[model samples]
Target chain A: MSASLPYAVHETAGHDNASMTTVGFWIYLMSDCLIFAVLFATFGVLVHSTAGGPDGKGLFELPFVLGETMLLLVSSFTFGAGMLSAQAGRKKQLLAWLAVTFVLGLAFIAMELHEFSTLIHEGAGPSKSAFLSSFFTLVGTHGLHVTCGLAWLIVMAHQVVRFGLDGIALRRLACLSLFWHFLDLIWICVFTFVYLREFL
Target chain B: MKAPLPHSGMEHAESHAHGNLKSYVVGFVLSLVLTIASFGTVMTDLVPHASRLATIVILCVVQLFVQLVYFLHMGTAKSQRQNTAIFACTSLLIVIVVAGSLWVMHNANVNMMPMSMSIQSALKHP
Candidate 1:
């Protein structure tokens, strides 16, 4: 139910058809969604395959992960605020919001990296069991997306500074909004089926 | 209720999408409430293990819809009928990819086990 994105830089010079960029980006997000779906399926199938290793229950810290979740949730809200400021043509406010969002996003990634490192340190690394393997694949992949998103946020903020909120900036902003919020959506599943399920 | 979902109209629908502050507040608050409730459901001894899983799953789905409406502006995007339809198809594929793989792999795991044990024992165990 979407179309067009900001004109791509590589499109033939005259073929700067800006109309399809957003929709095309939507399709790209859906395809990424499918990739997550497969990883999630792998996790579900092998969730019990711990092979005598430490499973999720003993490995996860609920409060710490909750802190991480809240960070991402608030970052999402901040990004939404950035989008609103952009919509109202308040470029400075938008940039401020983006800065808040970038820090929060960075914090979330830091916590995730910390979590992964701690696990690896304890000899509970991905190679420890099938469960760990699937766990790392699914959660690491999400972490990877957040990293790319933060990079995009940086580039977009720079573009906004240089170009103002021109057609290209607005289009890119809209896509980044989707990308950021979409990560939050995926995290809901991760927290539910991955983290919270340890208690289950 | 139906029409030739024009492309420009679709772009305008998506481009102008982001719902305002009130919606964002509602989505944010509702999401936190749902998330806390999910954690509480597991940590507190209030619910039995059997029902705990189901309860959290339900809460997760509800929170998802809450975010979709308030955060992603799905309500606004409804005007983009084709996009919505494509989204529906994508959701279907997600269900199949996840559920379908689990089902196939599970049965295969059971059936493909070594046959050294008695058939009755194997069947009972699997």
Candidate 2:
């Protein structure tokens, strides 16, 4: 019966390939990290150059930002659940968790978009000041990455359904999980250095 | 159903590949706590000014590692060793580049004597 376990052979056989894929994806994520690092450095340098425009204290709303943080963090947790389901070869659970992750991700993006629109409407658009420029660039880049991740989640969910947690699909799902969690990691930095620090 | 051999290296190894639900929950809880701590430190005037920044930074760093270890399942296992090295090197480079550039730019600002006002004066005088 152990020999006949459906996922056992595939799990063993896919180990090497999965390892390679995981490593490769990690390298990609590291490069992405560098991109964020540059944005962060730029933001740091320009944070004080408000050019008579509103500063973080006036621009950032803690409660709204906190809501966004909660959504992303919970989505990361849901993505983890999906990955666990994938590992267990429970396709329905995987799909359910992924669906939840996707919805939470969408909510995050919606909140971000709303914030951006509010800022722009308040005459704090990126071009209005150097501080705003860096702010938008740093945070907008993150929002863009989240958008892309959502798209990838959709593709991966579709693949899981089509492939039924085959070795390849499962490996791809693992990569996506890493990506999702990594975004959450970056968001922690953003929340601390950008939003919360404003109050300090 | 035959019991899996206890000494089967592959089975033992694969067990560590995909993390279980417990570890995921652990990571989630840790991160949530750290996040709340960060928010509390900033939202309230509880922490002293000098140490508040430090506290927030420490919280962020700890939460980052929690996500990495629990959610991402990153570790020093043999299979993950290479990826870890790659990440460590990339992180070092990021620190150098970001920190170095910011230091240089800040130092330049310190040396410069209010150039924007001077620029206005120059246009007026010329």
Candidate 3:
């Protein structure tokens, strides 16, 4: 059956176009999730291969990770708030919340980069061991996604300023909302699997 | 300059674009609690220490559901059934791929590391 058939009854929402886009986007996200799953599996397989370099137990600072987690979690909430403002047709509040979220995300990336650089300075660079390699790859990939998300947020804010809550703007923001929250979801997994497990 | 999202006069569209504030606040609070609980369990040497990892994984799963429902708005709703199906399938694949690799690698390590270790020791001694 055509994807468009499902929303035929509710054409008033103009979801005739948006529903298909949303579903297509969801499928894309699921594919991206699979990529993460593969990376996570690689990390699991190589977790013990420190090759005389530092392991997670010696390297991960939970308190620092917790701080980063707080920033990301708060940013996710602020983006949610921004989406709400967009729904209410309040473009100014939407932009404000997006800006707040962007700053929080930026701070997270800065802390992450600092953490990486510090690790390299300590000679625990990814090339030092298999464990470090997987760690950097998985965490670095997530960081890169957040970086792209920050850029997307900036673009969406520019779009909102120009177009207000028009159909296209709203739909794009909705997609970005899903994406931003998805990144937070991935971070939860990262901190749990990569950081907290170090305590064990 | 301001109109309530012209061209889509539907409640579902609004909810889809932006869930209500109550859900957002509730999800945020629940996620916050879950994160802290996981952190505290690890830091405080509580939960008998050995099961801390299990507890954290469980809490992480719960938090995932909380965010999925409230923030991403995935649920049994007709609109989300496809999303749910897709997620369920991906989860199955993730389990297979991750668990399969771990199982194979663990066995390989069990079978191979000792021979290498013995070789190293033999070389060291003779």
**Model 1's lDDT to the true fold?**
0.83
Q: Given the true complex, what DockQ would model 2 score?
A: 0.55
Model 1 clash pairs are: A1-B82, A1-B83, A3-A23, A4-A19, A4-A20, A4-A21, A4-A22, A5-A20, A5-A21, A5-A22
lDDT of 2 by residue, B18-119 (tens): 566777888889988998899999888889988998999999989988877777766776555676689889989989988998999899898974666654
Q: TM-score winner among the candidates?
A: 2
Q: How well is candidate 1 docked (DockQ)?
A: 0.40
Docking class of 1: acceptable
After superposition, candidate 3 runs with Cα above 4 Å error: A1-15, B1-17, B115-126
Better of 1 and 2 by TM-score: 2
Worst ten in a row by lDDT for model 1 chain B? B1-10
Which parts of model 2 have CA positions greater than 4 angstroms off?
Answer: A1-7, A10-15, B1-11, B115-126
Steric collisions counted per model: 10, 0, 0
Candidate 1 off by > 4 Å: A1-19, B1-16, B76-79, B114-126
Summed over model 1, clashes come to 10
Question: What digit string (tens of lDDT, one per residue) describes model 3 on residues A35-100?
Answer: 999999999999988876789989889999999999999999999998888767788999999999
On a 0 to 100 scale, what is the lDDT of residue B29 in model 2?
Answer: 92
